[model samples]
Target: MDARSRLSRAIGTPVLFCRHANRLYHRRLGLRRCNAGGVDPFDADWDNLLVLDACRYDMFERRADLPGRLERRESRASTTVEFLRANVDGRDLADTVYVTANPQLHQHRESIEARFAAVVDVWRDDGWSDEHGTVLPETVTERALRAAEEHPNKRLVVHYMQPHYPFVGADADFDGGDFTDAEADEENVWVQLLQGRLDADRSDIWECYDANLDRALPHVEEAMRELGGKTVVTADHGNMVGERAFPIPFREWGHPRGVYTPELVDVPWLVYEDGPRRAISESTPGERDAAADDVVAERLRDLGYAE
Candidate 1:
């Protein structure tokens, strides 16, 4: 172990050390795996790619009642940043238009602006839900419908921040706090569950997860119907709930970067076809609206990412 890790282990809480070790362990694992067997969404056949954030295959299989051919595929990464780094960074994709609700993509704004034909940052718009601490799937659906009409000739990639955290469904009360507040154990639902710091049970947590998916499915279905093309609904990555970290005897909580475990990497690939595939075309890259660094950080924190 490195000196920083040793010192952290010496002075920090056991959970803190485990967090560091787990990241180091899995980052090494990812280097060996190198995302060798994962599916690249760009190479897949689809006119519209709907990315549901932090959604798992098994949960999608059990809860998603959308019409499509659903199959499981290992993702290229275990976290949103890793996903964007592996699949989107340093690529020229001027034929596509991205509509996103997650603010994590801001890190790649320059690349995204230089590559994609257009980027609709719904998160920057008035789509954010301060009450729920996430951009509701319905808001994304509305923006996606408008984007589809506006860019009829371009491939659309709409990313929804749902079925993830700050669960805003009927079971939203299970874990309630300011997602944008300063970092604390209670602010992160997954960590709370992981450390036994919450009063809720595992099954209850699953209900909240399922309810979040339920909240997003209708909006996803709306997008599928209105977009009118080959739409593939998949996730950027899957969430880890009580899954044991491999080669380590600890139960992992949220999706950690570089972790290649099934709970964190395996995601749903639900392909649904409509009228016809879009005649996507390459065009001049468009400008993307910039958010202040503090705003981006606050929104990311709302999504359970701590600096």
Candidate 2:
């Protein structure tokens, strides 16, 4: 084929081919000035690590305003400052990496297995035991504590898998409600719908899912308290509880692909610390006490002990 025809076939359009060719020619001729004075991407401190699962950034933003406390980051440009704030106040923020609950992340058994395995490996390497079926959040927190104990000065990362589906096990000290065959069936149905199996209303399922989050918070709090260091809580992804056009068409459960709609993508970020709290307006002792109180309140609320 002639050069013009070959170029057209390669790019699928003569216009695109010409556009790209012109761009390349300009670059070779130094017509495009390269700017290298931008902000350094690697300037942030990486010594601390915080990982949250099933967390939505938008949700965090909303709750962060509940008490009208100063936000972690006032300007969008101060992400590094936000990270420091999380550690100083022991609060989780939306700055942590958030993995969207895309179809590839948890749609199939293999994918779920792989994702869990990766999380498990991170815990195991940090001295977590695999003999027990500890929840992902607890496992990660325990590992962080162990690391903090050994290194003392190093940053720690804790991962929590909350507000996800399949509410299979008891949460921390909570009575996980009744796990009868009916509940199991319900869980299966929710899972199927999440996985794209059967059509069903997700409102009820989402209620149960939020309950699971309430159930899991105590364990997370316990782990954080034990760490006795800067604690940041956030999520890797969030869930889409029946928003948008995507209904639970199947028995599949959990987050699905193309579902990163606002509902499933927003998460909560909280930070708590036990000592030397110099970042926020709160004092160290006061923040610690408040953190403890918050955990208790969350537990009581989940158990219907509080309004």
Candidate 2 lDDT (Cα, whole model)? 0.36
The per-model lDDT (C-alpha) reads 0.79, 0.36
Give the per-residue lDDT digits (tens) of candidate 1, residues 194-258.
66665555677777778889999999999999998899999999987787887566877888666
Identify the runs in model 2 with alpha carbons over 4 angstroms from their true place. Answer: 1-50, 57-136, 169-191, 194-196, 245-254, 257-259, 277-307
RMSD of 1: 3.4
- For residues 208-296, what per-residue lDDT tens digits would candidate 2 score against the true structure? 56555665566666755565545555554455454442232222223332232334434444556565522222111111011234543
In candidate 2, position 74 carries an lDDT of: 18
- lDDT value, candidate 1, whole model: 0.79
Error of 1 at 35 (Å): 2.9
Clashing pairs in 1: none
Worst 10 residues of 1 by lDDT: 177-186
